[model samples]
Target: MIIHVVAIIMELLKLINTFFESALFKKLINRKRSLNYIQFQRADHFLITLSKTCKQ
Candidate 1:
């Protein structure tokens, strides 16, 4: 009876681990996309600064 309980617990742990990993992966991807967006915005701001300086 103890062995059976242990087996069930192990299976539950495995399922939980898989769920966490998938969620983590999705979060990382979203983070990377946001970083890219930030970088693009920064580049645009830099270009605007340069253009204004050149016109002055």
Candidate 2:
């Protein structure tokens, strides 16, 4: 009976760990995507500025 209880507890812990890790991974991915988007926008602005300067 004790062994069964321990096994169940271990399974529950594993499931909880998995859930947390998935959530953390999704958060990281979203952060990375946002960073990339900002960087791209900055690059686009820089290119526009360079083109305008060249035109002058």
Candidate 3:
């Protein structure tokens, strides 16, 4: 009985692991990272423009 319970738990863990490593999950992560990068770039550009305008 103990062995059977352990085997079931192991199978559940494997399923969860595969889900995390799936392509859909990877796409979601990449999308989030790109969004953050775009936001950072926009903020940086705004600051640069603001500084240039101030100097002028």
- What is the C-alpha local distance difference test score of each model? 0.63, 0.63, 0.66
Clash pairs, candidate 3, are none
2-53 in candidate 1: lDDT tens per residue? 6686567556656754664697756865778777657755865775575466
lDDT of 2 at 37: 54
Model 2 C-alpha lDDT per residue in residues 1-56, reported as the tens digit of each score: 96686567556656754764697756865778777657755865775575466446
TM-score between model 1 and native: 0.42
TM-score of each: 0.42, 0.42, 0.48
lDDT, candidate 3, 1-56, per-residue tens: 96686567556656755775799867866878777657756865775575466446
Q: For model 3, give the 10-residue run with minimal summed lDDT.
A: 47-56
In model 2, what lDDT does residue 7 have?
62
Q: Output the number of the TM-score-best candidate.
A: 3
Angstrom error of the Cα, residue 35, model 3: value is 16
Off by over 4 Å in 1: 24-56
Worst 10 residues of 1 by lDDT: 47-56
